[model samples]
Target: MKPSILTISACGIFTTGIAFAGEQHLTCPARLEPDAIQPNHLPAGWELHMLRPVYLTEGGMLHGPPEESAFLVPDNSTSRKAGKQTREMQHWSFDVPHGYTMWVYCGYGGGGATLKLFQQVTESATECTLSSQSTNGRTKEVLEFSCK
Candidate 1:
């Protein structure tokens, strides 16, 4: 039997990937369009590649190595300090076309308890690098990759 996909939309912002109902090949949006009004926004012709999950264990641990596409670096500082949980900050560094500034951010779920708005951050393109901070294990944060 083929697995079913459960897509959750948020005010038409972005669509969630296929849910892991049983056993299925999950895939999310590959790229994100550049927006001018958006901070840390990339210029035209740049698309952010979304990272694919390697394996989400029952313990809420995201295990995977860095990929050519995009990957998150491991950061469990806060988790270590608080003695609660260990959350890793994802860092991605990939090659760009030729000339374009790279931008990184932790978007879509960080802030007030009631209002969960997306947040973004800018990074210098030393060699086309992007990154995301620790997550709350909710899978709402997005780690983008691209150059502007």
Candidate 2:
């Protein structure tokens, strides 16, 4: 059975209807960023796969196919790994507008990886600020904002 989507308004997080299957079913983009993968020093057979962007309204409703929806997919890459304790490093470039919620699902292939969202500095990749709050599902992360 397909999982149902439930949003927790107080926190802007989604919970699946499945008894204890804590994540939303989403796929990681198949395209790989060679430059990102090559430098990661990942194990053989592991590579950086991008996370596809899913947009939603602040009320947790699915948003649109914006004018340039194609660009939404594969904005950045994350390495495939086997444990949730570690998340491979990669620079992400997607931004959630001031009034929407965005969810990015990263399937590390073996089902284990912690997900977090960071705000990239305007000019430096290494300089970033962790979001004040974030919600992590089994293989996904979400960021939300209130409409002004």
lDDT value, candidate 1, whole model: 0.28
Which 10 residues in a row give candidate 1 its minimum summed lDDT?
Answer: 57-66
Residue-level error in angstroms, candidate 2, position 132:
24
> Clashes in candidate 2: how many?
0
Which candidate wins on TM-score? 1
Quality of model 2 by C-alpha lDDT: 0.28
Off by over 4 Å in 2: 1-71, 78-91, 106-148
* Candidate 1 residue lDDT tens string, 1-148: 2212323233323322222332122222222333311324557888554343222111111122112213234333122222433443333343444543232222232242221212121222322222222234544332333222
* Model 2: per-residue Cα lDDT over 1-148, one tens digit each: 3423433232333444222232222222322232222224558988655454322211111222222222133224344444443233322344455544333332223323222111111211211111111123232332221111
TM-score to native of every candidate shown:
0.23, 0.19
